[model samples]
Target: MDAIFIQILNGLDKGGAYALIALGLTLVFGTLGVVNFAHGALFMLGAFCAVTTQKLLTISKHVQDTSITFFDAYKDQPYLEIWWGDFGRTIIDWSVPLSILLTIPAMLLIGLSMERGLIRHFYKRSHAEQILMTFGLAIVLQEIIRSIFGANPIPTPAPDIIAGSAPIGALFGLDEALVYPWWRLIYLLFSIITVSGVFAFLQLTTFGMVVRAGMHDRETVGLLGINVERRFTVVFGLAAVVTGLAGAMYAPILSPDYHMGMDFLVLSFIVVVVGGMGSLRGAVAAGFLLGLLQSFASMNEVKTIIPGIDQIIIYLVAVVIILVRPRGLMGRKGVMED
Candidate 1:
């Protein structure tokens, strides 16, 4: 039971990232009728933001080291001095969460620019064309990040306060190895807050009301003199920022690398499909469900029975869900279009 509980916690955080990513994809599809292949790239970019911020924060200084513990180390008369002339390690050791925060506005701007400059032109393009264009864009974006940051997995160090394994099992007076890391718990909470805020914004705000209306009928809303297009652009940027924030926060739990987005993009699509192509609630629920199940599938017992269950868990769930509900858990009629 304890083992199961820990796995459940692990899944929630992983699934939360998926849910958030899928939600953004659904938003773009639901509101704009365009399938954004760039969504995952945005996610990738968000992770890279952390990578960039970490690199930016590093106070790199060349240091000559003579073993301070050994007095004879300087017997060769070689003097060691810290170069870059500053304490580069001090700032990094002090704050990591701050970089994630700095990543938000940066990602939001990136999102806005992508929307205004590229996606705006595709609002009326055919789905196939949009996919091709955006996929190409994603490729370009990934390559750009790779060129700049290299292909290595970038480690995002957690804040000093929450730097180690949390011992979830230890809290229950169990064993030591069953500990959960604080960064992951923080991730789960952060995703929840983000999901909640977006939900609340849509449910409680006038702007959200307008956006929802625009989602249903851009033509009708335009007829009523609403700036439907402008709201959509805002929403696009919002979706980008949301996904970017998710990616940025996720960087610590999962390594931030240029290719990480490609890994997440497929599952996110599956999550959206299983949740319902346009349903936010469905996306959130399905993300957790799939994440939990996937976590369980990796267990020795489950894998022994199903062999390679980890790789197949999501696809299996997607198949069953799609078969059970053709339009998704909450898809509206005609939203899938012809």
Candidate 2:
């Protein structure tokens, strides 16, 4: 029972990431009608934002260790530690969260630039062209990141205060052995809040209503004098910010690497498709569903019986879902119909 519960938590943790990424992808597709392969690059960039924040905070001077008389050894002592002492150290420790401030503006600008300078040009083009162009852009972004940050994965850890496991079992009156990581729980909550916020903004606000209308009939919204194209440009930027926050928060879970974005890109795309091309609710639902299935499939008992089911469960489920319901579990009719 404890093991099962643990897997459930694990599933939710993974699902949060999948759902966040898929949500942003769906937003861009629904609003701009553009298939953006570079969305993952934005995620990678966000993770790097956290990395850069840590680096900047820890800018250090080499200090000679006089105790090591045999060989001259120099320790890198951070400027923060030297300047403000413990307070500076605390700031350094909170670099991942602090980077959120930097990520918002940076990602927004990047999204706007991509849309205004490049994506806008291809709005009327074929899906294949968009895919090729965006894929090329993704590669270019990847290479640039690699050149700057190198090829290795950089570790970004959660703050010490919440780095340990939580006694979730006690809260639920279950076995105390059923503890979960504090950061994972925080991430799950974060995902829920972000998803809810997006939904609320879209459903309750005038700007969101116009954007929603634009998604249905862009020409009609234009005729209504709403500047639908401009609204969509902002939508693209919002998507970037959402994806960026996901990546920034996720840095502690998965080490930030130049290729990490590409790694999640394919799975996220599958998630978007399985959820329904333009359905936000479907995307969120499918993400958690697949995440749970993947976690359960990874259990020793299941893997022993099926041998490598864990590795293929998601794809297999996707195939089945596509075959069974062409429009997906929650997709509307004629979403992708020609």
**Each candidate's clash count:** 1, 0
Best by TM-score: 2
lDDT of each: 0.81, 0.91
Residue range 43-156, candidate 1, lDDT tens digits = 988877777777666634444345676553333211111332234345555345666677678877887788899989998889899999998999999999999888888888
Model 2 lDDT, full chain set: 0.91
Stretches of candidate 2 exceeding 4 Å from the true structure: 66-72
Q: Write the per-residue lDDT of candidate 2 for residues 206-291, one digit (tens) a residue.
A: 99999889988889999987899899999999999999999999999899999888888888888888898888998899889888
Model 2 clash number? 0
Error of 1 at 114 (Å): 1.0
Candidate 1 clashes: the total is 1
